[model samples]
Target: MKAWRLGWARGVVELRQSFSNGGDLVSHFLWPVLMLVALFFLRDREFAGTGILLGTLALPSILGMNAAMGMVSMSQQLTADREDGTLLRAKATPYGVQAYLVGKVVSVAGGLIADLVILFVPAMFLVDGLVFTPLSLLSLLGVLLLGLVATLPIGAILGSAFPSARAQGLVQLPVLAMIAISGIFYPLTALPGWVQVVAQFSPIYWLGLGTRSALLPDATVVVEAGESWRSVETVLVLGAWAVVGLLIAPVLLRRMARRESGSSVAVRREKALQRVG
Candidate 1:
């Protein structure tokens, strides 16, 4: 209980810093702005005679993509903290590992939600034909929450697996490829059947599908695979990932944290300085 309280406070402090820190603040806005720009170009274009504007299709899909991208943020933050010895410092404190983990989840989830609102509020003005019913709002909330549960633990595992920022950079390519195949900015129906089958396994794809189901009208289902939302499958796939990731992430994180030492941190710091030089 005390750990949760302290962790929540720490998370709130870090979340506030992210908004106030110049570089972090800029990053918080930049991606959403870029996404909005993309929506601007797509707002008027129609998707394959579905009569729904492409931007209408993309806005919610992009929201899902952003939600799933929390995984990347979690991974990157973990890598950065580990490199700088934050994990070691936390390990020395009482109940700190649990606290640190909680804080990361809170901060990352809060930041991701804020970013979504930033894009979504402005996007509502730019895009048309979106459904804004109470049920859809509930559905959106549920999907986003489930999507985070499904992805963030895997991200922690990735961060633990990669000891350095440079190694973490390699992770982005595969994630980007997943996003591409998951149909974030386009319809999944347009992709090859094999690709669609592959995408079905990705949490990102389920997130996208879930959001599109929530925000789009029933008629707009024409663009989905099999012209259906597959809500049950979305829930199942995301739930399964959430379960497996939760089970594995804690063990991996603890192992990684155990490997941290003062000497190791100093070596990494030296290497980082050398690289900078």
Candidate 2:
């Protein structure tokens, strides 16, 4: 209980810093602006006989994609902390590792919510056909929560696996590929059957599908496979990933924590300085 309280406070502090820090502030706004630009271009485009504007379909999916990206941010933050010895310092304190993990999750989730609002509020005016009821709000909230649970653990695992920020760059390609095929900016129905099947396995797809289910009208189901939202599959697949990741992350995090030391941080800093030089 004490650790959780401390972690929550730490997270709040970091979240505040992200909003105030110049570089972080730019990052917080830049991507959302880019996405809004994309939304603007797509706002009027027809979805090829679907009687739906592509923007209407894409807006919610983009929200979902943004939510799932908490994973990437989590991975990157963890890697940065490890390199900078934040994780090591936390390890020195009682229940500090636990606090650190909780702090990261809170900070990442908070940032995601901010990014969503930055995009969603402006997007509400830019897109149409969205349903906004109390039920839909609750549904969107549920998907966001479940999506975080499913993805954050995987992020922790990835963070633990990589030794440095440069190595962490390797994760970006696959994530970008996943976003492309997972139908963030496009409809999955346009893709081949095999591609659709493959996309279903990803949490990104489920996040998008879930968000669309909440925000889109019933008629939009035509664009989805089986002409349905597959709510059960969304919960099950995301839950499965959550379960597996929960099982594996602690062990890996603990192992990684064990391996960190003053020497390792110095070595990484030295190499980083050499590269800069």
Candidate 3:
């Protein structure tokens, strides 16, 4: 209980720092601004036969992609902390690893939510055809919440498995590929049938589908798989991933922490300095 409280406090402090730090603030806003600009250009363009503005469809999909990218941020931050000896220091303290993990989850999730708001508010005016009824709002919230739970723990496992910050780059290529196949900027129906089959297995696809379901009008359903939102399938797939990730993450994180030591941190730091030099 005490550790949980301590973790929560630590997360709050870090979240505050993320907003206060000039570079971090710039980073937090940069992608959303780029996305908005892209949305601007796409706003007038219409999807073939669908009679929907590309931007209107894209806006919600981008939101989902951004939410899933939280996983990458989590992995990168973990690697950075490991290289800087933060993980080692935490290991030396009593129940510090538990506190540190809790703090990371809180800060990462909080930051993702802030970024979503930054994207969503300006997005409402720039794009039209969005339906934001009370039910839609609730659906959006549910999808976002589920998306985070599905991705974050898996991210923790990735972070723990990678031995160095540079190795984290390997995680990004697959994520980008997943985003492309997941229909963030475009509809999946336009893609090859096999690709759609592969994408359905990924969380990114479900997140995008869920977000699109929440924001786009019911008429737009004709373009989706089964010509419906498949809300049940979305929940089932994401829930399964969440369950798997939650079960595996703790074991992986504990194993990773058990191996952390001052020597390993020093080795990583030396490698990082060499890269910089």
Candidate 4:
């Protein structure tokens, strides 16, 4: 109970810091603004036979992609904390690692929600054919929550496994590729069968699909697999990943935290300085 309170407080402090920091504020707005601009241009363009504007389709897909990017941010933040001795400080305190992990999850998830609002509010005015019934809102919230649960733990594990920020940057390349293949900007049905098969296995694709299901009209599902939203499949696949990630993340995080010490941090700093020089 005490740890939970401390973690929640820590998360609130970090979230406030993100708002107050100029660089962080810009980052929070930049992607949403750029995406809105893209929607502006594509608002009138048709999406093949789906009879929906490209902007309408792209809007929800972009939301899903943004949700998935939370994983990358989590990984990067963890790496940064390690380099700066934040993780070491956590290790020194009682129940600190647990509190730190909880704090990170809360802050990152909260920040993501803020970003979504920044994008979604303006987007509702910009796009056409968007359905916002009570059911749709419920579905959107469900997918967002499930997507976060599925991805963030794996992200923590990845962060724990990687030794440095540079290595973490490398992780982004594959993620970018996954986004491209996942059909965030277009219909997955239009992609080659092999690409489609590979995409089906990716959380990004399911996230996008789930978002599309929530926002797009039932007819729009014509462009999707089986000409349906596959809500059961979305829940199953994301739920499976969530279960696996939850199982593995603690083991990996504990292992990583156990390895942290002042000497290791100093050694990393020395190496980083050498690289900069």
Give TM-scores for every candidate, taking all chains together and pairing residue i with residue i. Answer: 0.98, 0.98, 0.98, 0.98
Write one digit per residue (lDDT tens) for candidate 4, span 166-241.
7887889989999999989888988999999999999999999999999998888888878989999999999999
Q: Which 10-residue window of candidate 4 scores lowest in summed lDDT?
A: 47-56
Query: Candidate 2 — which residues are off by over 4 angstroms?
Result: none
- Residue 59's lDDT within candidate 2 is 95
- For each candidate, the alpha-carbon lDDT, in order, equals 0.93, 0.92, 0.93, 0.92
RMSD of each: 0.8, 0.9, 0.9, 0.9
Candidate 1 residue-wise lDDT, 157-254, digit = tens: 99898888878878898899999999889998899999999988889998999999999999988899988899999999999999999999999998
- Alpha-carbon lDDT of model 4: 0.92
- Give the count of colliding residue pairs in each prediction: 0, 0, 0, 0
Candidate 3: residue 168 Cα off by (Å): 1.4
lDDT at 151, model 3: 97
lDDT per residue, candidate 3, 205-224, as tens digits? 99999999999998988878
Please identify model 1 stretches exceeding 4 Å from their true place. Answer: none
For residues 1-277, write the lDDT of model 2, one tens digit per residue: 9889989999999999999989999999999999999999999998887679999999999999998888889999999999889999999999899899888989999999999999999999999899999999999999989999999999999988888898877988888889999988888989888988889889999999999999999999988878999999888988999999999999999899999899999999898788889
- TM-score of candidate 2 to 2 decimals: 0.98
Ranking by lDDT: 1, 3, 4, 2
